[model samples]
Structures are given as C-alpha cells and as structure tokens.
Target: MSHVTPALYATLAEIVPELHVHCVEPWCVIGSAAALLAGADVSVADVDLLVSRADADTLMTLWAERRESVYEPAGAERFRSHFARFRFPGLPVEVMGGLELDQGDGWKPVKARRLTLAGLNGLAVPVPSLDDQIRILESFGREKDVQRAKALRALASSPLRGED
Candidate 1:
C-alpha cells in the first residue's frame, strides 16, 4: 500500500477516536480517502465516512456546532444517506449514514465487504480493502469512479506492491 500523508493522518487522528467512542455500529472511511489509504492513486478533497444511521445522528448531535446546516451533497438521485458535513482542522469530513446506491433494479447498500485497518499513531483506522474499494467505485459507475476503480485494479496487480 502507498504511504499515507501526515496531514491526512493528523486529520484522522483528530476525528477517528471520537467515532470509535460514539459510534456503536460498524463504520469505515470511504471514497477517495479510502482509495488513498488502500494505496490507489487518487486525491481526497475530504474524508467520507460510512456509518449507521444511529451513529450519524450521534455524531451530528455531538458535532452540531461544526455541521454544515445548508449544505446538500451532490448526486441525490444516485445516492441516499442520512448525511451531514462537518468542518475540521485538517479537512472537511462527511458522514454518510446507511448509504445506498440506485442500482436501477433497486437501492443497494454500500458496505465494506472487507475491512482494512490503516494504522495512524497507533490507531487502527478502518478502511475498506483495495478490492472492496474497487468494487464500490465500479458500483457507483460514474466516469470518475470508474477511472479510480481502474487505477485501483492496476495498483492491486502491481508487482512492486505486495498484498496486505
């Protein structure tokens, strides 16, 4: 896997502990952030957290002051979640509760098929594995997501990078 940046690690350090404390259900980082943690070549604008609805509510209530009251996430038709955005010192973090994708047949929950822990300052921060991340991106089917999935596929097959 590629190395995680200090800035990103720092940001995670600030937020992840509280998540572990407050969120009772399973949770993990997703989107470009997860890809980045999995060693895929991608840029992360902000942290995308996948959580249960109850956890989302808990976090929303806890971080009420930092919540973006008027912000609405893009891709309303493509995705659904009990979503909220928060401002943090290192970067913005978005919480997606029970996120589901519109798969034409029906809505399918986006879940971590395999959870990988990316260590940060002794904290085992949960992120989806590279393969799982690829599957998710492909499921999204957006041009950018497809491209990221391709990149992840390449990284997974790279002789230079060993399997985790």
Candidate 2:
C-alpha cells in the first residue's frame, strides 16, 4: 500500500495554496503542493502531486491537516466502488514522476534522487534531471512501467543534452 501521511498533506496546503500539484506518490504531497504556491505548473490527483523544485516552497506553518482522513481527488466519482490498491518498487517515493521547471540554465526537468528525497519535517519533493530521470526509469525492471515512466520523464526533463 502507498503510505501518505496526514502531516505531509497539511504541510502541502501550508506551502502552496494556489497551484495544482500533480502527485506520483502519496508522500510527495508536501513538495508538489509547494510547487504550486511557488508559481510552477502543477497537476493534482487524489494521491500525488507533480511540480518543479524552482516553484516549490518550504513550509512556514506547523503541520495542521492531520485530522483529514480522506483525500478526494476531483473526478474520482468513477472509482467509487474501487477498494484495492497497488504498490510498485522504487523510491518509497512520495514524489515519483518528474516535472518541468526552468532554472537559470534553461527550461529543464529534474527529480529528487533517493538520497535527497528524505527530509526532517517533511519529505522534500523531488524530480530528477531529464536524463537522470530516464536513466533512473530505465533502471526499473518492469518493462511496461519503464516505457510509460520514461515518456513522462522525458517530457518533463527537457533540454536534452547527451543521449536521451
């Protein structure tokens, strides 16, 4: 099962109250939420948020939304009868897929590596550099998953340099 903590969700709202943060995993709610507040492009789902670091914000408010037990993503009406969930191998990842954010270098995409993803108060959201995200996705053994992740990873990780 995917583990999404209540503190993470609260931290997300505290960080970004504006933008839509697309989520890859449940735990990454904090960083993706911040991305929206920071003026980055965002996508939101019931369980995850995808955003860029340049647009992400650090939380100033204490974690508050812990009381909310249900996270209802919009347009989930079709899934009402659903009950089971699935867990795939990879970063115990709060943030899974990478998104595009333009740093000084140019419009490029990045993701957080396994090492940098863990933080003290919250799991800092992350997206690896495009090539890096592809390399990382390639590392996953599931062939079908690799195909999908790599495509999204490539789209977000633009400004392709070496081989991509």
Candidate 3:
C-alpha cells in the first residue's frame, strides 16, 4: 500500500490519542508527488513515522487486521497492512512508529496533531522528533539517506516558514 487513507488515519487515531508525530521523508514528499509524476524519478517507498513509543501497541492493534507476513530487516517484529497505497516506486508506505524501527525508544506524545495532508479527512497521527531523526541518521554515514534526514532537520528547525 502507498497512500494512507482516512480510515487508516481514524484507526491510527484510535491508538494514539495524542498525535504529535511529525511527517518525515517519503511522506513529506507526498504533497509533491506531482513533481515525480511530471518526470521526477523519486522513490516513494514508505512513510518514516516517528510516533510516541507509548502508542505503539495502540497503533499495532489498528493495523492488525491487514497484518501481512513480513520480517523487519533489523530482526524486530514486523506488522503490515495490505490496503495502504503507494504513490512512489518500490516503496510501499510503512509506519515508523518507534525509534528502533519497532523495538526501541519511542516518545510519549504530549498532544494530538491534526494531519496536514489532503485526503486524510482531518485525522490526527503520531511520529517522532526531528532531532532524533538527525541523530540517528547522523550516527551512520549513508550519504543519500542522511541527506534525506537533513530535510527533517530543516523542518524541525523551522516549524513554520513564516514563524522564522
């Protein structure tokens, strides 16, 4: 699945009452899918979610219905939903709920956040902080991936373009 629907958003909201999760790469680029469709070769594989660790179980339950048989590359337990859509190539949107890809430190959301993307039907979601993303990506040097992480860093630094 590539694009997450309102139902999925509602389901996700059921889990994380306070959805302060930030939208990161792949997904961040979703608003710009038209650019890719217009001759840009970008990979829209998965949604790198950074949600509160506390809501992990809640989210798991919502997506449990479509759970597919897939293993995590890091050897952690993997969960999947067959219904999510993919607006990009090869990458089916994924939920990066916690820090350790599934078994690490995930933040406890302080508040609920309304999703800004269109078609979400005004639902809230969860995710992690920008600094964490930079730290994790910076630890190892995967040039391309790290570069992508930089975008998160930028967004974090400037919460609102007009605010600064």
Q: All candidates' TM-scores?
A: 0.93, 0.26, 0.39
Residue lDDT tens for model 1, 31-116: 88788877787877889999999999999999999998898998899999999999987788999999999988888899988898
How much is 112 displaced in model 1, in angstroms? Answer: 0.9
Report model 2's TM-score to 2 decimal places.
0.26
As a TM-score, model 1 comes out at 0.93
Q: Write one digit per residue (lDDT tens) for candidate 3, span 91-158.
A: 33344443332223442222212223322334423222334334544543446546646655565556
Minimal lDDT window, size 10, model 1:
1-10
Q: How many angstroms is residue 159 displaced in model 1 relative to the true structure, after the best TM-score fit?
A: 1.5
CA lDDT of each prediction against the hidden true structure: 0.88, 0.33, 0.36
Candidate 1 lDDT:
0.88
Q: lDDT of model 1 at residue 151? A: 84
Poorly placed runs, candidate 3 (over 4 Å): 1-43, 74-93, 101-136, 150-164
Instruction: Compute the lDDT for candidate 2.
Output: 0.33
Q: Give the lowest summed-lDDT range of ten residues in model 3.
A: 29-38
Residue 40 displacement (Å), model 1: 1.5
